[model samples]
Target: MTQEEATRLIGGIYDSIFDTITKAAPGGKPLMAPATTVLSLAKPSIAITPKDFRNPWTPGNPTAAGIQPALNTAALVDDAIKLSGLYTQSGVGISEVYGQVMDSVHIKTQAPNPANDKQLDDAFNVLNRKVEQTDPETGEKTTKTVESTLLTDYNTNMIAYNMAQAVYTAAYLEAQKTQTGRATWPMLAPNYQVPVKIAYDKWRSNFADKVEQAQSIMQTSSQNALSKAFKYAKDVFESYGVTLENVDKAMSRKIYRSTLLPSDWYSLT
Candidate 1:
């Protein structure tokens, strides 16, 4: 099989599983679109916004229906990458799947604390000292006093605060996951839970045998495609009197060089 064929197969299987799990509501309206347009290691980057982290799972919350499927999509995509051995070969890891998690939910940037900012400002004002400076270019000494330490102190404080804020933001986002799927708990008309649960039970009853088999076929076909491409590229370069050594030099050059190695060429080709 070719790479294109493998990609199509993977997408088809994913669509089948997704559609089964997220069957339409009673009115023939879909709860939401699929989590993604495509499923691939090189899928488009997901944009994570602030709202995702805070959306409530309460009944009638429109956003909640998509959350579980989005998370599951990320997991399945990551599984596909691992099974295909692409992550190992490309230096990409399962962490890429985490992008889907973050994207599916909203996370607000931590708001700056005015009191903390004031305290930091006050501390810097008291601790900062003046220093005498000379012009290095002219080798001329001057009686100029500068608040050099003050700027440095302020920057250091900012860095510390930013790090703390990052930690807080990550924690908040993680907490949101605990509430996933709760939106369907109220069991309103066509509550997503009943159909989704029924579908999942049916799918898992066979241990997801179909998806597993398709993924296995994809892995072999993708690997074979890569090998064929690699040989073609090697042949083209050899015809131009370019050796592997030349390719290595091109890859390693400081300027006008590729960030990829020859192995990466296999995937790109």
Candidate 2:
């Protein structure tokens, strides 16, 4: 299932189960009641035994599984629920008694599969590095961090990479169109005769700018790798007495469009 659906399903299941348990308890208040204070005065209790709650095959498995996992999944959820009076009788709200619970759950819930882990990991790595940069005007640090494992999944990573490729391809194509049929001078010869030297210089400057912008979209490592490959190509072209400028002109003339889909990256052998 999609990540949003999975999150909502898990969240809904937990809320439903919590509602039922609270209603059946002797002095338990409705789970949705707003508290006068953030901290609850009464301790809460679990209606079901821990073992039954943890088991996968039990009839109460879905509800129990939801609650048990949530206890350790997030601090806000666990802290609020555990500190309430739901678990006790003196002042029943919800469980206010605190205790350690299992931090992970193993159930049959359908969610994004484990195969997408590598994709999620790579995406986070890129985002982490990107976040460390300082904003130029404000000098304030800006970051966008997401903790979901599904973010690194094949689907998401592919989306990011494809976006980068599309931007790169568009810029490169525009550069190529502008550079078409441009004459090249062998050197800065004193006797060089060109009709419009200033125009040539302007075109060259714009081409450089576009290339730089395209390269900037990539992460540092990816940019470095591509630069290294291009350098190798440059050296080979130089062996034929081709200048670096001429080589860049030739390479930019070729348009490269990626045809690979995201699913192709994750296809099993």
Candidate 3:
């Protein structure tokens, strides 16, 4: 996306997570909670378990209605998601910015050029030019030229490529600031890890095991729900890019939205 779009995305991500946590926690205590806090309340003891989804073929089971709530609970304790909040507030990390740059490069390479398509070329040539319009209800065959508002796949793709290029530029600038020393490729610079190691460490040491168990339980629940002819949960899961249809392609991308600034690059320096 463009620098402006990227900025907006980062702000939106921050606001979404922070605001949601604020509303969920009493007096917004979670927002001020230390990154090291284990958040034990998110542990699997209270979450949906594999036992809850047993017997997929059983009649009158709650498997179909429970997938979403289980997934939501799993997300609450996800390390990557927790780091996303810190990532937004800390101006993101070096690896995250580079990941976005890689995505932009890939998008730019895949975008179809207008020159490759004759019809699209012709359409773009007269994109802003006048086009004839007809008034069908007036029973008048009078033709008047009006500005062409036609948008084609080529135009849409080029716009996406331009926005991606803008993001690439922003990422490059971010890399220049985050890089520790000279490197052949600035975008591929070192220290590609998250900025706050303590947060990750705390989560791993105290919460990873329980969270993983909870996620496993939720995954089992999702699979059972999908297999039990739960179309609603299947459709909802697919909307989030998760599908039992292709287990290999469940999570296509990992980099999330967050701004970049050297001053906010804590611990990584």
Candidate 4:
């Protein structure tokens, strides 16, 4: 989902919870609600669990469907993705940027299955390096990298390693800045762990036992939804290159535009 949409959804949820509590209170005297980390709620886990072969968000809900591997070299992936975005936004070929990143990193290795973890790590070592070259005659040296190039490009905006993170950051920032979230998401100047400690305390002292009764229903549903979304994203993104689907373009065209039903429905009658 677009960051704005997720922000709205999360905001609505927070509002609903507050409203329900307010109405249920004895005399409308609002209970002092404790501010909690709003990070986890930025994009709550999906409550609709997808089945084995039944993709819940196949061609639909493209914004909500996306995947990125949990990896050690995620930074490398981000570097490439951001560079690609810089190129894409400026009307340049994404492939050109990818090639540049690969070359500078000294990535001479190739993997048959680029999606594999081992293979990605191999390429990561290369892509994660600084660009360098040495003059043959004069022994002069120079270095260049995508980040350096990006810094010089005037057209660069919304830098991101990949589309999914780009979208997530927008949503995350919205939640962090929202009125309700500011108190909850801030860093404690003196103690960084204050919020974390409070969260842990709250979970143990009040929330955990209360969640048991609804676990099956909430847990099952969310897991299913997440599964489908994750699969759809992986299907549309390749570890080594540009996204398989351009979400905006794909969502724009009419699904049945090519159908024999024809443009004029009255003609069938």
Report lDDT (CA) for all predictions: 0.44, 0.39, 0.41, 0.39
Give the CA lDDT, 0 to 100, for residue 112 in model 1.
76
RMSD of each: 27.3, 29.6, 26.6, 27.6
Query: Candidate 1: where are CA atoms >4 Å away?
Result: 1-147, 180-255, 258-269
Candidate 2 whole-model C-alpha lDDT, 0 to 1: 0.39
Taking all chains together, each candidate's TM-score versus the true structure is 0.18, 0.13, 0.18, 0.15
Candidate 3 lDDT over 90-112, as tens digits, reads 34444445444434432113345
**How well is each residue in 147-192 modelled by candidate 2, as lDDT tens digits?**
3333234334445455655654554455455444123222322223
Q: Could you give the candidate ranking by TM-score, starting with the highest? A: 3, 1, 4, 2
lDDT tens readout by residue for model 1, 7-64: 8997787677657656686778554565543323334444444333333222244354
Model 1 C-alpha lDDT versus the unseen true structure: 0.44
lDDT of 2 at 245: 19
Worst 10 residues of 4 by lDDT: 67-76
Clashing pairs in 1: 52-105, 52-106, 53-106
How accurate locally is residue 210 in candidate 4, as Cα lDDT from 0 to 100? 31
Error of 4 at 210 (Å): 4.5
Q: Report lDDT (Cα) of residue 19, candidate 2.
A: 62
